[model samples]
Target: MNAQAVRNYSNEFLNIGVDAAALGMSRSVVATTNDVNAVYWNPAGLVNIEDYQGSIMYASYFAGIANYNYAAFAMPIDKQSALGVSLIRFGVDDILNTTELIDSQGNIDFNRVSLFSAADYALTVSYAKNLIFKDLYFGVNAKVVRRTIGKFANSWGFGFDAGIQYERDDWKFGLMVRDITTTFNIWNIDEDAFATIQGAIPGQNQELPETTEITKPKVQFGMARKFDIGRTFHLLTEVDLNLRFARTNDIISTGLGSIDPAIGFQLDYENFVFLRAGVGNFQKTTEFDGSKSLSVQPNFGVGFTYKGIQVDYALTNIGSIGNALFSNIFSVKIDYSFFRR
Candidate 1:
């Protein structure tokens, strides 16, 4: 068995993020996340939850060719601790499988074609606790990942995440480390199914591919603050710096690592109606004349809360400026406590 460790694009689907509100802010909620969605953004913020909460989100990518969905639930264990669970799915369905299109007689038949789906799934369990020190919290996550490509290949992966958050006089800071112990995926290929396609292409599909994949650690640092405007309006702002160990095309890159900075702001009226905007994913690109230029993604969102139900919508991009189509994401959050009589 040939084993290989993939350093780039391993478990890339997980990076798509969850929650319309977070995506709207270009994923800059590390320091300010406090609801069920915190399970994905920064688990440490889960300790701030006061009651049972559940959230669901859905988004279509690449002009509806791919679908992404997320759900999460969280509850306080006690005055000092909380627990959460989250699930994510990203897939492309109805893909035509042409490997079996040609039969023993080498005759082409449209009926021989079949449809399949390529999908990725992740399940995460999280725990958070308030520290003995005032205004400090810590959290950890254990996650399992599964991926499938029709009946030809499948993989299973496991990983861990840790986070910490501190607050002082209306100011918050947070740090989240994803895949802290390095995630590993073991793949199993169906040789029988793959053999049917060996001759489909002259040189391709000649051999089974690598079976092992490794995902390295990533770190994010965030800071947030809130200000009161007049009597009924409030404004919140947050900034996050995401760091990857390898050098890349981020705005700030070096041999040691690369940094991607994101900034998000939210304005609300009486905590009922909300508006948000963010900018991030800065990268250097080459123009037609060979001149380098910087590109960024900007996102906008709106939210409304009535009783204990919150609905949020965001317009975001899956690719860099002018390169990909924009997606509309929607999410709903429910506070179970609201139903109590």
Candidate 2:
């Protein structure tokens, strides 16, 4: 926590980002057959669903001003081609901004509230395609991000991710590289920077503050697989191996010299209902004290489909503070059959 801690108004959920159902019960939906939630988790899973399907989820968790919300829509292009789009918003509220200055008596004073609340948002476009043999599939996604920090300034950037999934039969395999070309620049950035925001000093020369920009990292490589138990039940599992070249030396970062690994799983019932769960770092030492390094207690979730719409929900234990409820993920998906002669 010491090395990877954000000091400003950053939306952590957008990065550690999870679908409403996944975030609940500790986020263990990786290996399950919930391709609907995979858009936010893995884009390759898009081709697994029916044609012209879309999903939306709204969460009321984290208690205070923090929020997590997202939506995803995916459709098959012919038989081997598929496309999708998603939007995610994470942020906090009620922030107090003030300026420091010197009074006539040489005492320190502060300016009034400069701004109100701040947030971060990501707009993403993703596409996927299946190979001729029916065992290999590929996917890619592009994202535009916006971030605001108090009186400092706002920054914007563009990023890209690519992935591939291979499955011979009932056993399915998945793999992806996240943030392959993630690039961020401080909006209206300059060397003099925030120095102009300075005020008069007691008796010394004029002083100006210095501000800097930080760049997001490009995490690489994640692997997953799903097993079918005959026809009624199924099991899904995955492991992510992330390595960032510019992680510690990035512009906007904590400068930590380390790698993060995560593992998770899911269970499906009748292909229409799902019970999912997972465990990983980042938030592990958090909820479950003395839990497994990767276990972090347990993550569980369930989802069902009726008509053409699907709804997935999870259960998390709060223990005392009335239980910190996360969010729910919902979507309308379609799966079509196209067999060649």
Candidate 3:
């Protein structure tokens, strides 16, 4: 059974910035988010922020083997405009970097080790405005990304995102272009630089070659429906289709890949209690036994709201990635409306 999981984008850290509710809903939230979290998912959703809002979230995998943290704030610019800022950090600490040792006999030694940390981070500034036409909204994101592999190498990149949303009654439609500008990561350590650095290390004898990675644009299409069962009960159903663009060896040749879809549902009672469920991160593989299988991760979350504060918790199954351990995600958000509509 050869099973390999592929992350849609080379920037895997993008997967770590979702809100608790979105994570619980299998990430089918492009059209459902309405708060500061929208800064990461779909900036167009920021138009739903009434006055001002702020949120912070943290998620740990396998008892802190890895950590993901996110924070965001959004405020209205005017009756039809909103702006937001967000930050995301994901990383593993205390990683041991091992280098082969050589004895007098030129025998290999395995005791030499170095400790370092690896991290991926991003900062985003977003803006959204309701168009003059009906309920149409448009938004954009300007972001900077940094990735580091210990001290050996680091990369910096800049990207832009844009999104549009249309709402009518209880239905919402959304489309987002993630990394619309085709982000490029420039590494600090190239082959020539690595050759000089590696030569100075007593135990190192090989040079490292680094290549720039280009993250192509991705498109997300989403639709959601809100059902008001009664004065105290409500349900939300949503779906999102994600398509990624990839470039061939020529770099200039790009095309769309397979479409991945996600679905989720949320139930709420009196705006005080909320329940959410979702399944995503899908992949198809043929095991060593030559059996075809489809794999997807499932997550569940619950939330409480009182006054202007909301707390959300999600139990996410990490599948084999976490040795079958369940990961926990927690988030808190506060919203205030200077003038109630």
Question: What digit string (tens of lDDT, one per residue) describes model 2 on residues 179-291?
Answer: 66544433533324244344322344443322333344544345566678887888767665444443331222334533545566667787677777765433322334544
Residue pairs whose backbone atoms clash in candidate 3:
1-287, 1-288, 2-288
At residue 223, give the lDDT of candidate 3.
97
On TM-score, the leading prediction is: 1
Native-to-model Cα distance after best TM-score fit, residue 119 in candidate 1, in Å: 0.2
Better of 1 and 3 by TM-score: 1
Q: List the residue pairs that clash in candidate 1.
A: none
User: Which regions of candidate 3 fall more than 4 Å away from where they truly are?
Assistant: 1-8, 100-113, 190-207, 246-255, 317-324, 338-341
TM-scores for every candidate against the unseen true structure: 0.97, 0.68, 0.85
Please report how far candidate 3 places residue 110 from its true position, in Å: 11
Error of 3 at 130 (Å): 0.8
> Each candidate's lDDT (Cα)?
0.93, 0.55, 0.80
Better candidate number, 1 or 3, judged by lDDT: 1
Which candidate order results from sorting by lDDT in descending order?
A: 1, 3, 2
Per-candidate alpha-carbon RMSD to the true structure: 1.2, 7.5, 5.9
Q: How accurate is candidate 3 locally (lDDT)?
A: 0.80
Candidate 2: minimum summed lDDT over ten consecutive residues — where? 1-10
